[model samples]
Target: MRTSALREQRHPTLTPAAIGRAATLALHDELSLTPKPGLVTLIDRGSHDDMDAHTFMRSLFSLRRYFVQIAEAGLAGAEFDVLERFGIAAEARMRAATGGINTHRGAIFMLGLLCAAAGAVLREQDEAPRPADLQRALRRRWGDALAQRSQRTSTLPGGIAARRHGLRSASEEAALAFPVLFEAALPALSTALARGLTPQQARLDALFHIMAVLEDSNLAHRGGLAGLRFAQRTAQAFLDRGGVARPGGLQEAHAIAGEFVARRLSPGGAADTLAAACWITRVCGGS
Candidate 1:
């Protein structure tokens, strides 16, 4: 397929709720020592007030990255085989470094993400996501691993963290609106994805939209300290401000961070400070 055609075809409709749910699932999938589904609560409990964009993005990306790495090791029976290869000693070491999320199914899911990313961007022209195409791309990307994953015990969730956050004042009416809202929102995500926005960008946009609605509805309280710590860990990779007097200034900070990302991606363009600031607000636990 031509480049434009390929781009158009790969864009899948994703709602804010779906993306949020995906983030939640990815977070739990990333952090849980054992498999569980309540990561949104975990993040609410863990995040703090001083966290920034890089920090927020890092937390999401870090777990997703770990998942991808393990998956790359294998699929199907190979996942457990690799974990067994890690043995008690290796698993202990991983647990110490990671929060104990390194499980067999997590490994398989991570591998699936790798296959998805590769098929989306790096595979042959014919191997993109299509209504009719599934096995072909899986075959090209994972080869034997695809077959193994199908037979394996794990299955990816429909969506994770689609739940609204904890808020100062939430309404029952808004709670019921999730389905309708996300159905409309997913296409925007798909559009952004088609524009070649990185998954990080797409995910970030979805988070921002959620925060906005939650704030409007007064749904939850900020995670405070946990949010900040998550931010600190995430920002360790890039520019770490160490500490800031007031992280809630929103406007100026996002300007700087967005620009930095933009400059990194396209050195000549202006940075995306606005988006970066929004990210900071999230890590800081804004409504």
Candidate 2:
């Protein structure tokens, strides 16, 4: 376990501040992982030109306080509108920080909810927040609100594109308690680590697993439904070929990255999901 994680486990009284910090760390962990197909990293901007690592950093910093505040709200049993208000304020700060770029928008929603859920779980149990605990807490506290959210028409490009392509929007995924995050992403990460893959390699595994199945609105928006399918097939093929563990795995991954760049494909939703998985791992003390 990480030293900080150990400290968290040793001390059962985890606070909103600590939960907030974990969210930030998880986002950074996702950001720092390089060679992500069509995604930005500290070393490379795989597919995006509007924003890079610097832009992402500014957005990440801008939302640090938002996570803490939301966690506090969750712990205090604040209503869904209260959480939405926090998210709206955070999004404004993110836009301001990145000069109106949409960096971390997906993350702001996904991780924001998870952080609040973790807070709610802590309030109920005052114990360590497990992945299941957080997931259940999110659904129990905000399932109805999220269900209503899913039915609303989205003016966002991703949501519009998803509706056009007959794909699932992120809000829809949230309404279902994030089956992919809990069932697909987290399990893949755990399985990869169990197989002795390096943490970086494990994350790559998790990201691809998410892409293989997620009807990513970002992918649909950028590349249309065809693009979404193409990305999914490519990701599935890579995993079937043994992922980043095989001898030529890195080369194949780079090749996939090249393809995404050429196709202007950015699996932004998958990237966000990967970040959420990282958050779960860190906060839940998963290997």
Q: TM-score: which candidate is best?
A: 2
Identify the runs in model 2 with alpha carbons over 4 angstroms from their true place.
Answer: 1-11
Instruction: Tell me each candidate's TM-score.
Output: 0.27, 0.96
lDDT score at residue 264, model 1, on the 0-100 scale? 26
lDDT of 2 at 26: 85
RMSD of each: 15.7, 2.8
lDDT of 2 by residue, 170-250 (tens): 999999989999999999999999999999999998899999999999999889889999999999999999999899898
Question: Which candidate number would show the highest lDDT if scored against the true structure?
Answer: 2
Q: Which TM-score value belongs to model 2?
A: 0.96
lDDT of 2 at 238: 94
**Prediction-by-prediction clash tally:** 29, 0
Model 2 per-residue lDDT at 212? 99
lDDT of 2: 0.91
For residues 232-273, write the lDDT of model 1, one tens digit per residue: 233332223421112542343344344323322110000111
